[model samples]
Target: MYVSLVCRQWYAVTRAVLVLTRPVVWLETTPSSQLLPQLENTRTLIIKRPQSMKHTTYVTWRDGEIQCWTETLNRLRELSIERKIKINKIEIKRHIRVDTWLIPLLTYTSLSLTNLELKDMVHREIPFGQMMKLCPHLVVVHLHYRDTGYIDSICRHANKPEYEPAELPDRLRLQSLKLDNVAIGRTILMRILRLSPDMEELHLKRVAKPRSFANEWLNTDDRAEFSQHILEQISSICPNLKSAHFSYYICDLRSLASEFHLAIDRNLFPEVSYWSFKWCDLSADTFQALKTTPNILTTLEIIDDASAEDHCQQHLHEFLCGAPNLLHLKVPKTLFSITWFDLEGIVSTVGHRHGSTDSTTTVSHRKIWACRNLQTLHIGFGCEGEIQESAENTRLIFGYLSKVCPRLQDLTIRYSLLSLELNRGFCLLTRLHELRRLVILTQCNNDKAWNVDWISKLITPSLGARMKHWAAEYSTMNLGIARARHPFTSTVKNPLLHHLLEPSIQSTVNGGDRRGDEYGHAANAERRKEGQLSQLVPDYFINGVDMRNLGQLEDIVELLQDRISKDWQCWPSMGFFELICLESDPNGIEPFKDTIRICRPDVEVK
Candidate 1:
């Protein structure tokens, strides 16, 4: 008998004891008859279609599997009622069509569900309106509909006729509605929205105007009218909406604004903040729309889209300087913000006034960010010249963030791996006392002079008191800073370098033979030969970081490595440490991990 349970809140289990208090339960397959009664405490039920079977076999038994799944859930629902325990959330994940198991499950357990998420559902006639009708108490609904890519519907025999809707709700108790990939038809979407008067969030991603009935598609003329109506009347329909995200539509926001001919006073989002620009490309119209956002707006996210130019994306520095009340600003890999943040790399102290380093000499007064309340940020810093300057600039970046955003708890930095001299000025981060999670993602750099092995000088300090392993599991710090160096042309004398050496070279490393050195010169020549290397796995310069040179990786690895030394304890809350490197160079990642693993043998290097 196989049993699995998943929960958001984690608990510790020893060899002698097991706890069944998990709130989130996943019914990945139809459970045995004995399983239902034990799952009465479940608060969130994630129903997912088992994906082990091939298309042919799945097509054959799809209906039967769904039926059994629904039957099991029905029994679970009965058990919940008997125990007076309600399942609050139901997330139907992967390629399962909602129509197959949705109505059947809800028919028995409608009152139990408060939150519903139908993700990656098949594009077919879905009884979404009926679902709202059944689960009138549902507060949050997330729906994503896409044509099933894995299964060719044309080749398979038609299952029964498409599902017909039986009922519709009058007034829904909804607070949030998220639609992805035009999940529902125009007729049904309107019906659901009209009912959800008190909706607080409407997140629309690549939504389309769907046809009402039959195997029909979109009507362009009808779509035009509906699009305009949706743009204009959405605020009126959901008057209580506080947040909205409209993203990745084929149609332009500028065109929509022009076609509607909206007045200056008729703000599209008067009461809400539109966050779609975070993931989607920002245009002139979208950039201009930010001007109308009220000072009360706290969260804003905009990602770098290569398709859009610099002017269209606007400046991140400008936004930060302006939005003083902003609690969160997330801009991922955006070149729009990489101007100058004046943090001086003080190689040595010149003078100290009142035992404090002079900020006037160190920090630039030219530009300053006013977003003092910022709690989370996803930003990148870049420079035009050599990447080493970026490494020097890292201290300044961390110093800037620590000063301006004192409340920052989560930060994701994007930059070149060569630029992340992880050791140098890492002490600046210890000032950010609230910083719970720090993620560093390396932006790709094709520069040939990349040397990650020798960035920081050996000023090593462990950033923790001895932290417990279970505590590390609860929180994590991730740094992904591995890029493949151009296969080295230079040869080294270290015996540890044998891994990257030829067998003939390896044999002669111990003896005073010239063969190893001669072979090393030849291997270096072949490594650089044009069209000579097939990069399924690149032969990286593995032993460039020899044991003698291990000090180069230094305290940067120690602070980031989680296991603390005896003396160090300032950054006491340090937890899980994750280091992700290059996929092409399997050898590139190992050298760094091998060094760290020697220190803490139990830590998994993956």
Candidate 2:
């Protein structure tokens, strides 16, 4: 029965080898009795080797192999002796905590192995240097976890030499090396630098956690010595290194302070520029740290969580003070009010969490007068100021901006009361030679009042007037037709004549009041009460013709176009009227673009 089971296992092993072509394909092994037929039937089990196949090998735990007949095993060993078949790659997995099974394949054959990965194999009391001596052409090596076991094995093999033994790979010319969770003290870092001289990529993850001695060394001198060790590695070993990443503050910040200075001393970092970090604390001293660093740092994003506001502000102030080649600057919202000393090389300034100032009563209006090359400014006004205070402040702030940042193109003032009148402080905005687009926004539900007529008159008069005229003409015609049964009533006043004649709407529209007769319905009165300005015309005009019903938007457009064509010299900028019906609230503007488009096709809704 045991013999039959061994035969079945050997057959399974032979079938597996026949299907798998690669020699080093990792697999779980079965019993030893299945070994003979598996090796003999290798030709039948394996596929025809690819013509381009340079090398192929197999690797698996000894236990994963099937049991073979004793007669087959003896025959295979004799065949190897007779035919000299060299194994290219071999891996003996130590599943049952066994030492590496050293085969005679490396000693007898001239075939050299390039890729070697010894995974859970017991490193029998042998130095790592000795293992490399067996395989000279090794390129990639991975030593992950179980470091203590391997270290114990290496110390056992430490030979008594005239000089101290090297702990790292010196003979092997490696390209990639990965050490994960491996306990490496300060000695290991310096050793790696000397050994893998041609190494390009290095990942020391969680390796710094327990091994970094700088954390435990309480004496400043001990910490300084530890820091010096790292600095020497960077200068001697990683001189040509293009990329580097290290964390957990393993080195003393005070000892290597000069290294930070030397980085920008020469024009060294031309190709190396991008820097990103978290929880970086730079006191007022940060300016001295990065002042002469050249224009290599073009884009920088810093997320600082400093307890002191001045510390954060001081760092940014210094960085911007010197970085003349910096094109874009993105800072936190808290620093906007911090009065920038030198904002050179910076064309754009983005302030996060800076739009509103509602709770604070007295906001000292700060102006950015230094940025001469500054073009775009986005100010987010907080919900602090009441309508009048907000409007007055807006005028003052925009006036300052126009004078200081003359080359401004696009300006967006968000969440504040918008004033069109160039009140004392606002007149300076007109001096901005390059100002083209200006946007003012307020909350969706806030009662933020803005005189649309005033803004349209100032920004785009031709389009503005056309919209005003259309509304006025429509209202007049509608009022004329919808007069009351008693046409001369005081309540139903003449809405149109009140505005054109100018003095007062009550005096102008109350013409029929003396006769004690009402003219218009309750709906018209409701609209008139909402600050509806009036206009005057002669009494002989169309009686009850209802011009509002007849005057469609298209008709107004055609009328304006005709007038402009006939009198182009008189009305140069005035042509077809373009109406942009903004959401009475700021939040509604974008969503209500369709509404404005449907009403006036030529109008720019957004």
- Per-model TM values vs. the true structure: 0.59, 0.30
Candidate 1 per-residue lDDT, tens place, 1-606, comes to 423435533222321133344544444364555456445556667765565642222223355665666667677667646654466787876555445556766765676788988765554445555777788789998877653332111101122224213345567888888766552344445555787778889876555423322223333333312354566666577777777665433434323333222421256556765354533344444434454444266777653343233443344455555566778777765643233443222222221111122224421123356676788887764443343344334555665566567678777776553233334344446546566666655533222222222212221332232223322432232111111111121233335564664332221111121222343555645653754532211111111111111111222343334333333333334332234442344345455545544443433434
Q: List the residue pairs that clash in candidate 1.
A: 278-301
Computed on alpha carbons, the lDDT of every model, listed in order, comes to 0.48, 0.36
Candidate 2 residue lDDT tens string, 135-193: 66655544433333222222221222321245444644654454433334444345445
| Top candidate by TM-score | 1
lDDT of 2 at 519: 36
Task: Report, for all candidates in order, the number of backbone clashes.
Answer: 1, 37
